[model samples]
Target: MINSDEILKKLAIESNIRQEEIPDIDLYMDQVIQLFDSKFMKSLRNEEEKVLTKTMINNYAKGKLFIPIKNKKYSKEHIMLISMIYQLKGALSINDIKAILAPVNERIEKENFDLESFYSTLIELQQKNINNITDQIKIQEHEIEMLENDDQLKQILFISALSNMSNAFRKAAEILVDDLLENNKKKGDK
Candidate 1:
């Protein structure tokens, strides 16, 4: 049976793509796809798992879900945005992800903020409590260990908690993004 720890260990520090990991300059669509594909492969998942695809990247740009590309090349901002969408897509709807990134995209367009700073800060924040997260996971592992006979109950509880956590993050992100969007609009009106 597949265990969370095994899946998570494959993720390790490689899961979060550091700003230094990707090219600082713009990249072609295929380059973007290749990067994502290589990352997915590390989890030992099938190639057909479809983490990111050409059509999806095109669709994201068409939908303006992130900062659009320039001269057919995706900037660092684009990479960060795409990376985030890939991470969040599993837990949130496309529209929800769009809303979450809206403010950042606007700031990028206005030259008010660069994605390098934002992405770096975000990565740092996520890593700050990495140990705590691992501890929590170990606790969950112990709890599941104790309830081995009640596998169904454990699955239900774990999924419930996961869903709640996803919702909490989504709601908090929505508030910040919405506020940022509003402030930008108000500035434009002035």
Candidate 2:
């Protein structure tokens, strides 16, 4: 049997970038790329995978996902926002991410929002979800073990359960993004 404890440990390690790890001063583009590469090295599927590139950063700027850069350097807040974009890109379109982050970006521009504190709260919530997911995995494994001696069926069922859960969460996120966009439109119209 696979080691569930090891999987849980790996998940916890690979899934987070603590707020303190971010550099306090601004970084050049290359430095930003290097930071993400080092932090997310284990999460990469292959050695050749690039975590962040100059083009991607430029494109994100063009998309207005965050405030404009200053003097060819990225601030700590910019790095945090880019990290969020990296996480969301796998499951959401760029438009969807833009829609979701629009209000936050506005606050950062107009109100000097404390992104560090907001990111800390997000990390706490993520840790809670990780614990919940690990518990769910254990339950699923126990149920799989109780089934009849059909290895193929067990594997299929386990994968299906995970896929279903992913689909549900992705759909929920899409729905929320749509609602946010609608509300923003209504406010603009008023």
At residue 139, what lDDT does model 1 achieve?
A: 70
Each candidate structure's TM-score, on Cα atoms with residue i matched to residue i, is 0.76, 0.90
**Candidate 2 CA-lDDT value:** 0.83
Cα displacement (Å) at residue 168, model 2:
0.4
Top TM-score model: 2
Clash counts per candidate, in order, are: 0, 0
Global lDDT of each model?
A: 0.76, 0.83
Clashing pairs in 1: none
- Candidate 2 error regions (>4 Å): 1-3, 6-14
The TM-score that candidate 2 achieves is 0.90
Q: Write the per-residue lDDT of candidate 2 for residues 1-190, one digit (tens) a residue.
A: 3446755665544466678998999999999999988877777656797878899999999999988899999998998899889888878999999987888889999997999999889878877787689888777767876873677777777777777887898999999989898899999999
